[model samples]
Target: MRINVLQHTPNEGPGMIEDWANAHGHPMVTYHPYQFGHLPNADETDMLVILGGPMSPNDAQPWIKQERTLIQTLRSRAVPMFGACFGAQQISKTLGYEVTKAPAKEVGWAPVYRQSTVIPGIPAELTVLHWHEEMFEVPTAAQLLFASERVTNQGFVLDHRIVGLQFHLEPRANNVREMVVNDYPYIQGSQLNQTAADILTMPVLAANQRALFHILDYITADN
Candidate 1:
């Protein structure tokens, strides 16, 4: 399967999603829209994976709009899609929902509560890394699947083919380090934010990788 990843920044790549694809013998390609300002043809893409970014989905940048257009086209074709953080907001915004500033910025390891058992393998509560200040509202017709104490809209599953998450489950230690180093200034002051040391030193949780693989498998499953 051809898994196309729409990446917004250099620091935020596919990470373990690439690992999953490799393990499953699927080819994964990543597009840096922010830099190249180009996207792949929807007809050529089998599955769409949108990675997180520092920019808001509501931005007026041409690349952002182009990305949204691609998402719409893919959704129309019923292609499986998985989004993370800013990518989640993009999906929600394209679905006519709002992406607004969260009640509070969740910038570190946090726990999300599962609201529905529609997607199995994810525990009732799982601690995942977070670095987003904006949150997406659950789209109409989409099932709200996860939530956290501070963020009511942590995740949602739509049509059993698309999944959007507000947190980081695919980032490995190196990915986390890159993000933390590149955006160090953004992690200051918030009580929800974790220090660089804690974020980097935190042991990698096997559960996060398992949950991420489950999500990818569920979304891309042939139904």
Candidate 2:
């Protein structure tokens, strides 16, 4: 499968998702619009993977607008898509849902509770990496998949093909370290934010990776 990755920034790349793709012998083509200033056409992509970034979808930046337009076209084509954090917010906004600041910021490892049993292989609760202050409402056409203490719309699935996750299930230790180094300012004051030491010490990577694989298999499976 040709997985097209939409990387928003240098720090937040595809993380373990790339590793998973490589291990499965799937070729991944990445588009760095933050540096390249352009996006790939939807017809050239088999599956779309949108990575997390620090930017909010509500911003008026030119690249953000371009991404929104591309996401709209991909949605219309029913392209299988997976989004994380900021990417999720983009999908929600494109689907006519409001993306707004959350009551509190979630910036560390936290438990996400499953709201539905439609998707297989995911447990009822799993601790995933989070680092966003903004949240998106579940679109009307989608089914809510997960929720957390601070965010009601942690994850959703649309048409059994498109998936959006508000948390970072793809991040491994290296990815977390990069994020911590790049966005260190947000890792303080808030009770939900964990220290770099604590986050690095967590043994949740294996579990999270397993869940991510299940999600990938589910989305890529033929109905």
Among these predicted structures, which one has the highest TM-score? 1
* Candidate 1, lDDT over the whole model: 0.90
Looking at model 2, residue 43 earns an lDDT score of: 84
For model 1, give the RMSD to the true fold: 1.0
In model 2, which residue pairs have backbone atoms overlapping below 3 Å? none
Q: Write the per-residue lDDT of candidate 2 for residues 1-223, one digit (tens) a residue.
A: 7899999978888888988899888899999987788888878887889888878898888998888898899888778889999999999988888999887788888899999887788899998888888888999989999999877889999987888999999887888888888887888865585787777777655878888888888888872
Clashes of 1: 0
Model 1 spans > 4 angstroms off: none
Model 1 C-alpha lDDT per residue in residues 1-223, reported as the tens digit of each score: 8999999888998999999999999988888889888999888899999999889987899989888889999898889999999999999999989999998888888788999898878898888898888899999899998899998999999998899999989999899999989988888865575788888888669998999999989988883
Flag clash pairs in model 1: none
Question: Residue 45 error for model 2, in Å?
Answer: 0.6
lDDT score of residue 140 within candidate 2: 90
User: TM-score of every model?
Assistant: 0.97, 0.95
Q: Model 2 segments beyond 4 Å from truth?
A: none
Report the lDDT of model 2 for residue 202: 75
